[model samples]
Target: MALTTDTLRIGINKITDQVDPMGAHLNELDGRLGDGDLGVTMVNGFKNIAAVSDDLPDDFGMACMDCAKAMTKVSGSSFGTLMGISLMAVAKQTKGQTEIEWDRLPDLLQAALDAMIARGGASIGDKTMLDSLTAVIAATTGKTSAQDALAAAAEAADGALIEFFDQPCKIGRARIFGDKTKGMDDPGMVAIKSMIDCFT
Candidate 1:
């Protein structure tokens, strides 16, 4: 089935609900390496997105574009900017489409991933959100259905978090901590997993 604006809104709500309670934990995680406000930034951004979700256009791409704008507006952090950029990239690629097809999933995912990489200058193993996002793209590459793909993506993201626990931060403010970041799960990756889980 094609993804609709209503369905997208539902997914966003699920993600926000899942992340809301974890905000404090996420902030704690960030405190060990980077700015301790990651959780608040993410929660605020999603809250802003939710506020405008009801009035979004019926077109899926346009809705995504609006969400991107809302996210960037409410959260001026790097994480928020990356999220907005990813959504904007998805909007650009899916332009005019009211729904997405299974076959089109790879392209959409790639577009978002590429945008994040370009804008954030981070790659896999960088201990950033890109690590989990890259895993999601890889795991969902051969999947034929949204349910299967999203499940795979969620699992991949979870696994990435496990691996990230032993790795040191390589980019962003977290990198300054060096070895101190070792054994700590990257807050960005954790957030990615949480978001992906909502679709599973």
Candidate 2:
């Protein structure tokens, strides 16, 4: 199956439903290492994205850009900015397309990951959501169905969390905490995991 604007709308709704309830918890996690507004960023970002869902164009690339713009409108934090950048990267690749095949998801994700790395200056081993995205790209590379891709992505995201839980964050504000971040979850990674869970 292919993904279109309808898929985007449904995905946004699912993610918003899941993220709304976890906002406070996300904030609590960020509080230990950063400004503690990660949850606020996430909550507001998805809310804005949902608000524009119905208005998105038939072109999936343009629709993705609209979602990215909506995200940037609500948040200027590092995480939020990276999210926007990633969406824009995907937009560039899919521009004018009415739909994208599920098999192309890995390439789109890779584009997002590469853009985030270039713009955010975060490496794969940094114990951030980039690591999670990297894992998802690998896991979903050959999957050709939305259900299969989502399940693989969910497992990859969760695995990323477990793999990095004991490692110290190596970038952004969380990195400032050094060893204190070792046993703690990276708020960005957790945010990614939470959203991926909604799809599953």
Candidate 3:
């Protein structure tokens, strides 16, 4: 599907529906690691975004940016804020464009990565959302095929998550896992990657 405002809204909407379920799952796993609130946090962010869909801009990037601002205002959680930032970042890259072309998706994804990095401070393998996002970005950094790109994005996220097996957790609830987390992948990262897969 073309990345129009309505299409983007549908994308976020579908993902929004999954947010609570995904968040709950992530939180359950987090309880095994840290605060166990990551799921709740994500759900709250998406919930807020869902509430504002009626006001979304017609342009894809503008819509994303608008939603980002709305999420930032509506959400009180860290994950919520981060989501808004990433959305806005993608939107930022498309500010000058008349439309959201498939050709620009790579840059948009990278912009989200940049935003995530600048705002979240998570690294390449921090057992954070970055792992999934990084994998997606790296896989289709400049490739075409919005569908393939989205697919590659999800696949990369899964692959990046595998690193958690032996890699150390520097951020998120997994950081508290210590030894227990060694065998488990970061649930939030997994969900983020999984959720992104839906758009394809």
Candidate 4:
């Protein structure tokens, strides 16, 4: 199916619904390695996105841009800022389109991933959202449907966590924990997994 504005709104609402309940858990996870505010940041960001999604224009790209703006308005943390920037990059690639074709999803996702890495200076094995975002892009490559892409992304995220938690964080606030971060999942990766799961 084409990724229309209505469908995009539904997905954003689903993400808000899915992420709202995970705030406390995310905070708990963040407490182990970071500032312990990841959950609250995510909850607030999605809440803002949901609030403005309906008022966004019918074009999927414009709606995404609006959501990014809304997210940036309420997101005070680095992770939230990265998320907003990634969405904005995707919006730029998809500008003027009412719906994204299934075949083009991977390219759009890749654009977002590249932008996130450039803006955040994080790479694979850094234990940042980039790990999960990379996995999602890899999983979506050549996929023909959103369901398939989402499922692959969720699985990739799950697998990525196994290795990510085994290594100490090399970037972000979590890096301060050094070896102590070992065996603890990156809160950002977990959040990515949760968001993708909403699409499945």
Candidate 5:
């Protein structure tokens, strides 16, 4: 029910295993609006994270910091960098804690969202992963059970894609596509959904 280094390791392993098969699909989705590297960034990022998961410390903050560093080592992709930034924010908030209650999930996500906003210059309505993260935070708030929180997070992230599917991306390289970006799912949002699905 509580988040520990084991939880982090399990999640990273799940994501790494689940996301590999999604690489081509994600690349195709991003090709329409971005550099077609989103899939690579995600797959490699999680793989790298998994590679270091076993060494994660019980201190949640240090574990998160290590995870963030692993994610950033994948490449110079903006998505990878943002993922690192989000994890860094959470690491700071959860520093020194070996076991975090599920109720704090929402606050952690909020910290991530705020950090991503500040670092990536993307807002909630920008149709990015930030929006998906915002949805997850709203859905998981007040949840004290890990099972409930995971379900809420997965459902909310999936819903975010549906909600923003018809909307044009408002930032990043996707914005350059302008009207064409309309009706296209944001790759980052879809990535969040896919990653969350692994936890379920």
Candidate 6:
């Protein structure tokens, strides 16, 4: 039902250290279209996690709650709000568990996907972090290990980005680039995919 506290901590750390780099990737890819602050925002958001990492809930459900609160508190960006709400969804599903059953991870991830969709109002193939995250989730769902799953996710994210280039943005500033975004790949997708690549 929940992962160990240690895994949760690592997840938080991974977000902090990788979020910026991922943001950097997105900024480079879509900076001309957007505010170019995805990296800075994610970096700052994750940085704050380290300070309160010790306060992470002992169980997975509680941990999710804590994570959402922390992200909302630390980040003032669109992505942060989405991430926070996503975690809140996960927390809701995993309400009181100590270790997540590997088999249930897919459900957890799917729940998160639903949360983001509901909050951000972005559909699949939007070239946003959701695209990347969804791709990874699809690939990792039935895989045996986080490493293998993440590897699949990264590759999937890359492919998803390609698909996104053909569609005009429906939600954010990236919409301006529409046709010109043809080969650029969404920055958010790249960043999220890269982070999964590292963990995988």
Per-residue lDDT of 155 in model 2: 95
lDDT, candidate 4, equals 0.83
Candidate 6 TM-score versus the reference: 0.87
List ranges where model 3 is wrong by over 4 Å. 73-77, 96-98
Off by over 4 Å in 1: none
Residue-level lDDT of model 3, residues 117-195, one tens digit each, is: 8878787667777767767767876666667777777778778777666666777655665666677777667667758
Error of 4 at 86 (Å): 0.6
Q: Which regions of candidate 4 fall more than 4 Å away from where they truly are? A: none
Instruction: Give each model a TM-score.
Output: 0.94, 0.97, 0.86, 0.95, 0.97, 0.87
48-75: candidate 6 lDDT, tens digit per residue: 6666788887777888787777777754
Candidate 5's TM-score: 0.97
Best by lDDT: 2
Residue clash pairs of candidate 4: none
C-alpha positional error of residue 22 in candidate 3 after TM-score superposition, expressed in Å: 1.8
- Can you write out model 2's per-residue Cα lDDT over 101-163, one digit (the tens) per residue? 999999999999999988888899999999999999999999999999999999999999999
Candidate 5 lDDT tens digits, 27-145: 89988888899999988888888889889999999999999999999774699999999999999999999999989999998999998888888888989999999999999999899
Kindly give the number of clashing pairs for every candidate.
0, 0, 1, 0, 0, 4
> Which of the predicted structures, 5 or 6, would earn the higher TM-score when compared with the native?
5
Q: Worst lDDT window (10 residues) for model 1?
A: 73-82
Q: How much lDDT does each candidate structure score?
A: 0.83, 0.91, 0.72, 0.83, 0.89, 0.73
Across residues 1-200, which tens digit of lDDT does each residue of candidate 1 receive?
77788878887788778667767778888787777888888889888898998998987889999999999986445888888999999899877888787757777878998999887898877888888877788888878787888888888998888878888999888888898888988888988887777666
Off by over 4 Å in 2: none
Off by over 4 Å in 6: none
**Model 4, 30-78: lDDT tens per residue?**
8877778889988999898888877989877888899888888764568
RMSD of each: 1.5, 0.9, 2.3, 1.2, 1.0, 2.3
